[model samples]
Target: MNSSWFRKLLLSYLPVFFVVVTILFFVFFQSLNEQNRKEAIKANEFLTQQIVLFTDNSLKTLNYQVLRDTLTADELRFFFGSDNDDVYRNIQATELMDDWKMNNPIIDSVYIIRLKDNFVLGDGSGQAADFVDQPFIQTYINQKVTAGKWTGKRSFRPYAVEKPTDVITLVQGFPHFSTDKSGYIVVNVSLSKLKKSISPMYNPKLTYVRVTDEQGATLMSDSGADGENSVLSHYISPYTGWAVDSGPTGWGLAHVALHFYNIWVIIALVAVLLGVFWVVHVTRRNYKPISQLVSLIRTSALINPYKGQSGNNEFGFIQGALEQLLEETSKSMQQNQEAIILRKKHRFQEAVEGIVSIRESEWMADLLALQVNPVGAHAFVLAIEIDRYHQFIETYHRQDQSILKFVVSSVTGEMSGLRDATTWAEWITDRRLSAIIWVPDDADGEVLSGQIGEQIVQWVQSNLSFTVTIGVHGIASNLEEIRRSHEIAGNLLQYKAVLGTGRLLRPAQLEGSEQRVHDYFGTIHGLSQSIRIADGAWQKHIEDLFSQMQDSISSRKEIESFLQFLHQQLNRVFLELSKDYRSVWKDSGAELLELGRSWETLDELKQGCLRVFEEMASKLQALKDSQRTRAVISDIRTFIEENYHNPELSLDYLSDQFMIHAKNISKLFKEAYGYNFVDFLIGLRMDKAKQQLLTTERSLQEISTEVGYFNYNSFNRAFKNVAGVSPSDYRKQQTS
Candidate 1:
C-alpha cells in the first residue's frame, strides 16, 4: 500500500515542480542577459562620443594652427609674395609645398591662391587655370575670412587632360601683403586622408563608427552597409558640423541570446534532474514514516493518532530546499562571471603597471591561465602619451575623456594582437597609456615593435584626430626583464620635451650614442674669463658651452645644473660691472630665461643661450667704446715715455700694446699733444738725448744709440727736426 502511495505522489508533483523550476530559470537568465546587452550598448555610445570629440579637435588643430603655420612659413611666403612668372621663386614654392605635403601625409595638395594674379600654385603639375577655375574654388574665394572651411568632397583635375581626383579641402585666407585683397591659401586634405584620420575608431567586432557631413553623405565609414536592426548612436561635432554614428552589429544581441540559450539548457537540465531526485527521495522516505504511524494507530488503539493528520509534510520541505538550492546556484554563477571579469581586468592592470613580480614558474603559469604566455617570447614596453593632453582634457567632458582613454587602450591592444604580439595595455594616467608586448622569440622584435608603435600612433592620429607619441623600450630577453624595459621606456618618454609630439622614440635615441660630453668645466671657465676681460669672445664661449650641453647632457636635471652654474657665474661678473651694465645684463638674462620656456629641443636651448651671450657681448663692447678718449691718450703718452729707447716704438706698436686700432692711436696722439705721432716721438727722443749728454758726458754716437736712433746722422736729424739744432748743439746748450 505504501509503495503504491509513493508512486502516486511522485507522479502528481514531479511534472508541476519541473515546470515551475524551468520558468524561474528562464526568467532569471533573460533578465541578466538583457542587463548585459544594455551595458554593452551604453559602452558603444560612449566610445562613439569620444571618437567624435577627437575628430573635431584634430580638425581644428590642423586647420587653425598647422595650416596657418605652413602658410606663414618663410618658404611658402616666398612663393606667395612673388609673381607667378618668376620661375625660380615658383620652383622653390613648388618644392617647398611638395615637401610640406610629404611630411604631412594628411595633406593631399597645398595651394597658394594669388588673388591679384588669379593664379594658383600647388604641389601638383598644372597651370593656375586648372585649379582656379573650379566652381568650388571660386566659391571658397568669395567667402570672407573666418576659421577655415571644408570644401566638401569633390573631384578635380590639376591638369587639363589629367584624370579627376576627389579631395576635401580646408580653405583659409590671409592678406598676402597687409593691403593686398586677393591672396588666399587653400589646403586640400583628401577625403580619403581625412577618413583615414578617424579610421582607428572602427572595430568590426565592437562598434561601427563613421563620420558624415551635414548632407548625410558619408565621409568615412569602416563598412559601407549599416547593420540591419542595429542600435545606432550619433554624436555631432561642434567644431566641424559633422555627425559621427556608431552602432553594434545587428547580430550582436542575437549572438548573446544564443549563448544564453545554451547556458539555460544546461541549467534547466541540471535543475530538473535534481528536482526529480529530491521528489523521489522524499516520496520513498515519507512512505516508511507514514506507514509506521498508521500501524501504531491500528495496533495500539491510539485514539487520535490519525484524527488531525495533515498531508505529507516532506513535500513542503522538498520544495523549500529545491528553491534554496536554485537560489544559491544562481548567485554562485553570477559571482563566478563577475570574478572572471575582475580577474582579467586586474591582471591587465598589473601587467601594464609592471607590478607583476612573481617567480618565473608562477608567472608563466598565471600568464597561461590568463591566456598571455610570455615564455619563449620577446618582450618590449611602449609608453604612449597623448599630445596636447591638457587641451584634450579641457576640450572633452570628464566622461568623454574616460571613454577616449578606454578606446585608445582597446585600439592599442587590438593592433598589437594583429601584429602577432601578445599585448596588455592600460591607462597609466589621464593622458598616457602603457602597453607591454610579447612576440615570438625568433621574430625581429625591434623592427616589429617599432612598426606596431608607429601603427598605433598613425591609427590614433588618423581615426581619433589626436596625436600620440610612443617611446619604445629596448627588447628584453625574457619576461623577468620586462619591468626594467618598461622603466627605460618611461624614461624615453621625457624626450618628448626635446623631440616634440607625434613621434616614435627609440631606446637608442636617448642612450646618448650621438652625443659627446665636451669639457663643461673648460667651457665655463673660458666663458668666465671672457666676461671678466670684457672680451667679445664671451659669445663664442657661451655658444660652445650650450653646444656641449646639448650633445652631452641627456638628463633635464643635468642640463638644469649646467645652466644654473652658468647663470651664477654671469651674475657674479655683472655685479662687478657698472649699474648700466648690470641693468643690461639683467634684461638679457631675463630674456634668455623667457626663451628657455619655449625651447622644444636641446639645440633650441643652445641657441637661446648663445643669443643671450651675444647680446651681453654687444652691450659690453658699447660700454668700452663709451669710456673717456683723453684718458686713453694720456695712458699712451706714459707708455711712450717709458719705452723711448726702443726703435720699434711707433703707432702700430702702440696700437698692439694698448689693444687699440692704429689709426685711433695716431689720431688721439695728434689731438692730445698738438703734434703727430712721429713729431711727438722725435721730441721725446731729443729731450732724452739732451738729458743723457748733460748727465753722463757720453759720446754723440752713444747718446744717439741710447735715444732709440740707429745712426748718428738720423739722431742728429731727429734733434734738428724737434729742437732746430743738432744733437751735439742740444747737448752743449743743456750744459750751459
Candidate 2:
C-alpha cells in the first residue's frame, strides 16, 4: 500500500517538474548554439584577416616596383648619371633613401643589385652575386622584360626557417636608363619586417589566425602550433595564392563553457536574493531623512519664526537647525531692510542739501569729506538718467530688474576712479544716477564738466546703445554753497537748449561771451562772418574752443558742465544763424533747436550742446574743398605706416583720429592715389614684401604672411605687380 502511494505522488509531481526542467534545458541549449555560431564566425574572420595580410605583402612588392621604376626613369637617368657612376649613385641614394623609408620602412635595403654586371650599391649584408639568381629576383627580371613590371615574395634560398627568422624576400626589378635596360635596380625587403607591419590583421582577441601556402603547408600561426593539421592548415591567404583559417577550438569552447557556467550561475542566484533584501531594507529607511529635510525646507521657504532646532542624530539634524536659523535670519533681514530704507531717505535729503549723498555707498561721506572739502576747490555734479528704463523692464520682464541693477552697479564701479579725488556717484532714484566730482580750485568747471559729459556719452554709445545726459555746475569754493552749484547744474540740465543730448555741459558754456555769441546771432554778424572769414579761421576758432575745453577738464562733472556751456552758447549762435540765413540752415536748423528742447533738465542740456557741435561739424564738412580733403587723405596714409604695429589701429580708427568721415577719406584717397584705399594699402604692403625678400632670408611663406597676405597666390600676384618679378626671382637677384 505504501509503495503504491509513493509512486502515485511521484507521478503527480513529475509533469510539473519535467515542464520546468525542460524549459531550462531549452534555454541553455539555445545559448550554446549561439555561442558555437559566434565561434564559427570568429574563425571565418580570422581566415579573412590572413588573406588581407597576404594581399598587403603582395601590394608592398608592387609598390616597390613602381617606386624603383620612377627612380630609374627620372632621378637616376637625368640627375644621377649612368648606373656605373659610383659618385652619382651614392649621392642620389643618400638624398632619396630618407624619402623611401618614409613610405615603406620594411624595405631592408635599396640598391642597384645587378645579375650579369655583378655589382651592388647599398647598405645590405651579402654580395650582389649572392642575390642575382634568387627566385624572386630572377622572376622580377623575367617579368619585367614582357610585362614591364615585376614584384613578389620569396624566401632567401640559403636562409634558415626558425623562430624569429627572416621569412621571405620582396624583390622588384627596375631598368637602367643609361643602357638599353641591361640590369636591374632592386629593392629587397625582409619578410619578418613585413610580418610585423601587418600583424594587426590577425587579432588574437576574437579569433585564431593561421597562414597556409599553396602546397597546403601551414606557414604561420598566432597560436605557434607546429603539429600536423595545425590552425594554419585551414587558413587561406587571400593574396599570393595562400590559405588561412581561424575559429575557436574545441578545447577553448569547453573551457569557456566551464568557466562562465559556474561563475555566472552562482553570481546571478546570489545577486537576485541580495538585491531583493537590499530593496526592502532601503525602501523602509529612505523616508526618515527626506521627511525631516522636507519639514526644514518648508520652514525656510516661507517666513517662519518658530521652527525647532535640530537634534544630534544623523537623520536631518542639521536641516532642522538650518530651518531655525532661517527663521532668525528673516527677522534680522526685516529689521535691516527697514533700516536701509530710512538711511536712503536720510541720504536723499542730504543729497538735496548739496552734501552729495552717494546712494548704496557706505564710504561716500568719507570720500567727499577728504576730496571735496578743501577750500577754493570746485565740485561738479552730473545727473545720469537712463531713458525708458520702465520700457526696458516691461520688454524684458521683471526678472531682468536684478540684471539691470547689476549693470548699473558695474558702471558705477568703473566710474569710481574719480572717487580717488573725493568724486562719488550715487543712485538717487530708480533709473536716475548722480555724481559729485571735486576739481582743483583754479580749474575751469566747464572744462571738467565737458569731459564728464563726453565720457558718459562714449560709455553709453560704446558699451550700450543707451542715452544719458550729464549736467555740470560752476566751480564752488565754499562747501556750504555747493547746493547752489548743484541746483544750477540741475537747472541747466532742464533747459531745452540746443546742446548734446547725452553729454556734459557747464555754466560758462551755457552763458558764453555775449559779443561772440551775437557774431552767430545778428544778421550783420552772419554777413561779416560769411564772406570776410579766412580760409580756415572759423574752423580754427571752433577747434580752439574744443581744444581748450579738452585741456581744462579733469573730471567727468567738469566735462558735462563744459559741454552744457558749449551747447547753450552754440544753440544761441545757431538760433541766430538760422534767423539770419533761413535759406542755408533749413531742417538742420530746426533739428538742432528741437534736439535742445528734448533735454529733460540742465544735465540733458549739456548733451544737447555736444549734439550741436557734432551737427555743425557735419555741416562745415560740406564746405571743405576736394583738394583739402585729398591733403587729409595723404595725412592718413602717413599715419598708417607709423601705427602698423597697433593692431587696434584700422581705417576706421584713422578716420576717427583725424575726426573726418571714413567715406570722405576713402573718396579722397581714390582721387589722390588712383586706387581704392585698401588697394593702396596693398601696394604699401607689397613694398614691405620686397624689402623682406631682399633684406632678409625669410621663407617666401613667412614673407607673404609678414606683409599681411594670408595666401601665397595673392602675395605672388601682388608682388609681381609692385616689384616686377616673383618673390623667388627677387630673392635670387638680390643674392646675386
Candidate 3:
C-alpha cells in the first residue's frame, strides 16, 4: 500500500515539477535575449554616430577648399578686372571653372555670379541665363549677400540642367576689388560622391544605415531590407542637421531566434528525462538500496541537498537541487563573462605596450580568441594626438575630457570593424591615442591604413570640436615586429611640432622626400647685411628666409641648430652697435630664442622670427635716419661750393636734383650751418665774386655771370647787401 501511494504522488507532482522548470527556463532565456538585443542596438548607435561625423567632416573640408580656391583664384580676379565684352578673359574664367570641376571629383559644377553686371558663368552646357534664373540659386545669393557671410551646406536644384536634382552647395561672396564689382562663387559638391566616401562606414550584412536631412528626406542609404524585431539607432549631425539611422539587417532576428530555440530544446529534454527518472524511482521504493543509489546519483548531478524528514522525498530533493544548480550556473556564467572581458582587456594592454612575455604560440592563440588575427596579416601602428592639447585641456573639465576620449576610442573601434580590419585602440597617454591595426596579407595595407587614419581624424575633428594628428608606422609582416612598428609610430609623432598639427605623417614622409637642407648660412649673411645698413628690403628677405626654413628643414635638431646660429649672428651685430641699439636688439633676439623653444611648427617659428626682425629693423632704420640727415646737409653745402658760378644753381634746382623737399632742405641747412639755404648760396657766390674781382681783370658783367647772377646789377646789389659794399669795393677791401 505504501509503494502504490508513493507512485501516485510521483505521477501527479512530476508533471508539475517539469512544467515549472520549463517555465523558469523560458523566462531566463527571454531575459538573456533581451539583454543581447540592447547591446547590439547600442553598438549600432555608435557606428551611426561615427558615419555622420565622417561625412560631415569630409563635406566641410571639400566645401571650404573649393570656396577658398574659387574666391581667391587668379583667373577669376583677371576675369573681373577685364572689360565686360572681353571674350579672352571670359574664356579663361570658363576654363578655370572647368579645371576646378575636373580636378575635384566631388565638385559637380562650378559657377560665378557677378553682382555688378548680373553676369553668370557655369560649367554646365546651357546658357548662363538658365543658371541665374533658378529660384533656389537666386535665394541663396540674396541670403548670402544679406548675411554678408559664407553660406554653409544648403540643398538646391542644379542650374542649367534639363532634369534638376537636389545638389548640396556652398556659396561665398568675393571681396570686391578696387576696380571690379562684387561677385559670388557657387560650388556644387556631388552628393553621390560624398555618399560614396562614407559608404564604407556601414556593413550591409550587420546593419541598414541611412542618412536623412532635418525634414526626414533620405540623402544616402545602404541597399538592405529593414527587418522586423530590429532595434533602431540614430545619430544627429551638429554641422548639417542631418540624422544617420542604423538598424540590424534581415537575418539578425532570425539568428537570435535560432539561438534561443536551441537553448529551449535542451532545457525541455532535460526536464522530461528528470520527470521519467523520478517516476521510476518512486515505483521501485521497495528496493531501498536502489532508491538510495538513485538519490546519490541525482545528488551528484545537483548543486544542493534537501534537508529534514518532510522535505526528504524524491520530489523535494529534485526541486531543491535543480533550483540551486541553476542559481549556481547563473552565477558562474556571469563571473566567467566578466572574467573573459577583463582578460581580453589586460591582454590587449600588454600587447600594445609590447610587454607580453608569453610564448609566441600562446600569444597568437590568445590574440585569435580575442578576434585579433595576427597570422597572414600585415600589421601597423597608428599614433593619434590631439591638436593643441593644452588648449583642449583648458577648454574642457577633466570629466568631459575623459568622456571625449572614450567617444574617440569607440568611434575608432567601430570604424575598424566596418573595414574588416582587426584593430585595438587605447589611450596610451592623456592627450594621445594609439591603435594597432592588422589587415589581410593580400590587401593594399598602406592605402587601407591611410584611408582608415584619415577617417578617424576627420570624424574626431567634426564631433569633438578639435583636431588630431595621425602618424603611421611602416607595415610589418609578423606579430613580433608590431612592437617596433609602434615605437616608430610614436617617434613619428614628434614631427607634428615641426610640420604643424592636424595632418597625417607616414614613414616615407619622415625620410625627407619633400624636405631639403636649407641655406642657413646664406640667410644669416643676408640678415646681417640688412641689420648693419638698415636695408629697406630686410623685412622681405626675412619673410623669404623663414618660408624656406618651413618648407625645407625637416629635422628638429637641424632647425634648432639653425635658430641658434641666427641668434649668435644677431648677438654679434648687437654687440657692435651703440647701447640704445644693443638694448633693442637684445630684447628682440631674446624673443626669437624663446619662440624657437615653444613654437609648435616651423611656420610659427618663422613668423616669430619675422616679428623680431621687423622690430630690430625699425630701430636700425631710426639710427640710419639720424646719420642720413647730417650727410644730406653736408652734400648740399659741397654742391653749392662747386656750382656757385652757375647762374641756374639755386635751392629749387638742388631740391629737384636731390629729390629732397625744398622746405626740408632749407630747414636742415639752417640747423646744420646757422644759415638758410638761400643765404648760404648768396654768401658762396659773393665770396667767389670778390676773389674773381681782386685776382682777375674782369668786367662787372663777366664777374656777375661767373657768380651765378644773370645781370650785373643783381650781382652788384647782392654783393653790396651781403658785404655792405659794391662788388668792386668788396674786391678792393679783400685785396687791402
Using TM-score, give the best candidate's number.
Answer: 3
Q: Ranking under lDDT, best-scoring first?
A: 3, 1, 2
Provide the lDDT at 465 for model 3: 91
| TM-score per model over all chains | 0.34, 0.29, 0.38
Candidate 3 per-residue lDDT, tens place, 627-647, comes to 789998898889888887888
Worst 10 contiguous positions by lDDT, candidate 1:
300-309
- Candidate 1 backbone collisions, by pair: 115-182, 197-462, 197-463, 198-462, 198-463, 199-463
TM-score of model 1 (CA atoms): 0.34
Best by lDDT: 3
RMSD of each: 35.3, 22.2, 34.1
The weakest ten consecutive residues by lDDT in model 2 span 519-528
lDDT of 1 by residue, 1-736 (tens): 4789768776767665766768696768867886766776677678778877776775666666545565466655666667777888878767766765766677777766676676777744344565634565666566543435775567755665666667777766654334344566666667677666666656666566677788888777665236434545677888778887776654565445634655776776677777777777766765777666656545654232222346534334435445556776898999998987678777656654557666667667877786765534578889898876656877889999878888888988888788777876767677777788887777888888888999988898888967898989858765557777777787777766556568898867756435544587678878977976678787788777766655553565566666767777778878987898888888887886776555555666777777777777777777776566778898889888899999899888988899999998888777777888887788788888777877896899988888898788888877787778777777677778
What's the C-alpha lDDT at position 489 in model 3? 80
Residue-level error in angstroms, candidate 2, position 509:
11
Q: Which ten residues in a row have the lowest lDDT in candidate 3?
A: 144-153
Q: lDDT values of the candidates?
A: 0.71, 0.55, 0.73
